[model samples]
Target: MASAIKRSRTSFLTALSLGLLSFGISSCNGAWRQRIGIEKQPVAEPLPEVSDGPRSAPLKPGDNVIVEAVDRVGPAVVRIDTLKRVASPLGNLFGGRAPIQKQAGQGSGFITRSDGLIFTNAHVVEGADQVSVTLPDGRSFSGRVLGGDPLTDVAVVRVVADKLPVAPLGNSNDLKPGEWAIAIGNPLGLNNTVTAGIISAVDRTNAVGEGQRVPYIQTDAAVNPGNSGGPLINASGQVIGINTAIRQAPGAGLSFAIPINLAKRIAQQIISTGQASHPFIGVRLQSLTPQLAKEINATIDLCKVPELNGVLVIEVVENSPAAEAGIKPCDLIRDVNGTEVKDPSQVQLAVDRGRVGEAMPIVVERDGERLTLNVTPEELPRQQ
Candidate 1:
């Protein structure tokens, strides 16, 4: 009986040793938690209950304006996740692609009207198979793409929720260099990242691209791939621009935004009508300097112009309003509707401000002769 009791004690001690050994090995493996999630054990193995995030500290006097700005508008900003269907490269042995692969992408946006209307970039939700928007308050909803205008890179999204936060819109026209600028977005999958800078410049037309001119607001704020469609805020917490693109080359600090004024104009049209129309005169132009004038004089001949600093017409699309008005290449643009235009952006802006289908009077210098031509504006095509 004593020997049997000793054997029983020895067996119990061995089992306890093996259990400790197994637990130590599993604890050292860091990835174990990912595979083995928390399991509820009834009273036998109790785990500490996790608490929600800490409450925000109360606001005090003399707070930084940037902090105040974020506190006001951060709740309105949302993260937009998208899934796009793409063809898979590793398909059947026949060298064909499979169409079942889904690619994930992310961006950011803000509420504008509070009735579920959100403004984002067209490239964010465009052609997406699925869109999901996550608010800052830990609520999410399936997003609907109401309308998207790729020409202006603006899109409107809708979600069904009550008491949505809205970011107030500001006049981008009133923005000037050196004003405080703030950026908030989900960059590199990190949500609600905030960065601050100043308005580096405004009315930057060439920042978007070579041909597609949008007067972008340039800022030094940090913007990344996932930061697209986020808001660029002013000192008063008003949204001045939509964070769009960043320079890929040297001076990588330069980031660009679509002016909120232009965005609102497009958004209003998309909300009311199914699409937005851009009035264009159908002419490509370059700002003429003395050096550029010299190049034109020595290059292929369409028309000759006196050496001057003004907007130089480069190409006129066939059957367009400019061609119909007899505005030819190498013609130096002097004025649009009697207002002198110093650059190509100003010329485009004047035409946009004027009524479409109405005759716009323009003056150009051709071979030392100033000629006035009347051209009617027309709606730009989607691909334009």
Candidate 2:
């Protein structure tokens, strides 16, 4: 969600339904895609024909896209096992278990580089005392965590092996909602599990967590525990997204994946610098519709909103980039970097893409006057 992506400015007022995987990853379940209930799943919709963009080809009636995609990328998927030291109260008392017992966790990941570099979720290797990476060919290696960006839930783990199988990363920006989505992972300790569905949505953002900034891809593909950090490939047999977490709606639990576009950017940084930087210009935003604008004007007396549909700047964080740029409360954000932003998510996406210390120009309307402001984004505070 935008709330989790690079200090994304908040727009929604309601609580998000997503259960972020950074906390209490149960051993029975893995990390990211635990199943609350599967028998109660909603009926699947009819499958629509999809194009693979540049790789689009005519599909024969007997052509199995899932099998084809798996054959191409399955060898690169790996099972990750973590051993964390946990403090136990029954520290060898009365023949009980010893103190600081070893807690094990299971999750999935894929090799993104030929030089033993692996891509996985931050939660998977966050507190692990030791990480064991097992390949499909029965090869295991002790993994070293290069770094992890918890705000984005992206991490990079490297092994000493050479010439690893690399899964091809696709352009997530080219993914359409109706395109075929194939998930390959180790779910519920089932290694090399494959699931097929369609891409339900893309650019899925909202309040997921306080500091997590992930443009999640929504899919009907089943993701259970131990599926975290696995690749959600496209029909072209390319990694379009990384199966991250699930958000439970009414009767169904919607599986979500982090877009490869965002994941690759964060992953590259982790590979190079062992840490990631998230640019932030702190400002609380709320998308305003015509009816919402009328209500705000009628009730809110602090500042009257302009008669336009755009993102309304609610609160400019103190000493933030928005404050340094003289952005004020009740300002209607109209444009950023020559692009008109109608929703808070768009603004968040723009700000997230901006490089740290770069001067980003913004246009906001206050009292019907359009004022252009130059905001120099800074690294988000690490505490959050």
Candidate 3:
């Protein structure tokens, strides 16, 4: 009986050792596969050398012309910093994570008037419990939220400072594609960082499905996260537009600026009523495509009415100016008040320049016939 028991115990020991050896072999195979064939790490490229010395680009004589623009506008540009306690997710032993508190955010701005009136994007200072502005002269001041226009993403703030530098407004209508555009602002907390680029495009109302009526000028300038509300200036040192948006991602050479003419319009309204008076026409217009133009008038290749004309109306808002003036959806509007509308923007521009209760004549083509409709413009209610 004892001999039999000893034999059984030896057999069990032999099986255990074999099992352990098999496990070790399997583990070694996995490690070898990882090291030899399966795993390949990406090669890291060397970073670009950043010089510690004063990095200055070789300037041409024409570049010196911008010196005055920089010097004159530099003082008005202000730095904006914000702090807010935000909830952060913390590691947890259980499946549920704990909430941790953290402070976050960044931005820029500029003084618009001497009595502390400031200009900036609504998003920059929105929800900021405490707002502060720092001048180039190292003078810090408290900012008051005068009002904000979310449609245009423009906001006004006032700082109680004496003798503030106000930037002179310029006509954005004069800006052309390829014109020099200088942007001066605090980007990424680097105060007074100036970037230069050209006017890539104009009247670019590239709306991202947003229902707002504000049009934006698109540029290829290297505007980044913190450039909102900065000025896009021309060579004459006039602000052509307000820097507002960039591409949804980093690399797309697309940046958008609110037209300075539009900004001036909003700013004037805000300064007067603490809000913007957005102009509206009660008609939805669609560009007259060739096919549609042919459908409306078989003979007229280019629909030109006697009074005012250009875009073909698709719909008139209920009780809107066009509707009240008996304007139909199929009517092709070729002119407004004496200005002939060549495009949708030109129509908008004419309507935008006109005030509520002002009467203007719009020429249209209906069934190969030309007719004039008198429209008494109405104030489009301020969007909430």
Error of 3 at 275 (Å): 0.9
Write one digit per residue (lDDT tens) for candidate 3, span 1-384: 000111111111110000000125866677777788785544655422111112223234564757866776778888876565555555563757556444555677777666677778888877666678888889998777777788778887777876787666667886788988889887777888888888888877544332334567777777888888888776666667788888765546587888877776677666667776555657666555555444445444333323333465655566566766777655677777778876665677666666666567777778677787777776666544
Q: How big is the positional error of residue 361 in model 2, measured in Å on the Cα after superposition?
A: 0.8
For residues 304-376, what per-residue lDDT tens digits would candidate 2 score against the true structure?
7656678877666666777767877778888887778787777776777777776778888889889888887
User: Once superposed on the true structure, which residue ranges of model 3 sit more than 4 Å away at CA?
Assistant: 1-63, 82-105, 207-215, 248-252, 292-310
Residue pairs whose backbone atoms clash in candidate 2: 4-212, 4-213, 5-212, 5-213, 33-224, 33-225
TM-score of 2: 0.81
Per-candidate TM-scores read 0.77, 0.81, 0.70
- In order, the Cα lDDT scores of the candidates are 0.75, 0.77, 0.66
- What is the TM-score of candidate 3? 0.70
lDDT of 1 at 186: 95
**Tens digits of per-residue lDDT for model 1 on 232-317?**
99777778899998987675578999998888877877876667666666676666667665665676454456676887776667
Q: List ranges where model 1 is wrong by over 4 Å.
A: 1-61, 94-98, 248-252, 298-302, 337-339, 353-355, 367-369
User: In what order do the candidates fall by lDDT, top score first?
Assistant: 2, 1, 3
92: Cα error in model 3, Å: 17
